[model samples]
Target: MSKISDVILRGVTGAFITNSGVGKIGMPAEHSAGLQQAAASGIPLMAKLPSDKFGTFIGYSEVGIGAALLAPFVPNKIAGAALTAFTGGLLSMYFRNPENTQADGIRPTQEGMPLAKDFFMLAIGLALMTQNEK
Candidate 1:
């Protein structure tokens, strides 16, 4: 691996390690509500995962996302990146075109988290990926 690649991987992996680690040791604070909603969406599917397993799923998810985002940089990086992305995407799906509609130009960031660029990011990110790719 090139030094530059090493540095980039180091930075990305470190961030994944930190955030995912938090999900394991504590919780993915910024992403918790989304995940819970995701789990709640699929009652039977999520119910199979015990309460204690929430963090485990989250840990593997973060690792997966970390690995995916790092896939181009390092083969192993896909482990974390894809995992977290799957979790994030799973949660994001629920947010997309939410069951309850919002007024024009308004999006909610959880119950009381207020609305901001994060909504744009969430929507844009969703659009960028979900859009038809020919």
Candidate 2:
């Protein structure tokens, strides 16, 4: 594994841990409140946030820590090159064709996406997450 792969993996890990962790934490309360508020306001309450609040912690932490461990191994020459390339390709595909998510609507303050490795991989990982939902 080379230093570059470590860098990419760490970048990805850091991002996933932070944002996903926040959503995992804050979303449930907000979701409940939103649903209640929407019901009060006679609006359609789209409960995107489910009652099981802690489950996201497991997935986010697992992936973040997993990525951190994998980062160092990404430089391992045995399979580092191939893994990094695959991650890069997945990232590239997401960057090229980003699916504007409803989550983006929740917080409109975020800037446009960049060519950063983590976001690229996030697009890939997030896609995988969605796929796995089936």
Highest-scoring model, TM-score: 1
Candidate 2 whole-model C-alpha lDDT, 0 to 1: 0.40
Per-model C-alpha lDDT, please? 0.46, 0.40
lDDT of 1 by residue, 1-134 (tens): 23454445435554644475455744554355555555566343564565555665767655655444444444333333343345454444444435423454245435413223234334333433443322
The C-alpha stretches of model 2 lying farther than 4 A from their native spots are 26-28, 32-119, 122-134
What clash count does candidate 2 reach?
4
Question: What ranges in model 1 sit over 4 Å off?
Answer: 1-18, 25-38, 42-44, 71-101, 104-106, 109-134
Clashing pairs for predicted structure model 2, backbone only: 1-75, 1-76, 1-77, 2-75
Tens-digit lDDT string for candidate 2 (19-49): 5444554346555464334322322232343
Which number leads on lDDT? 1
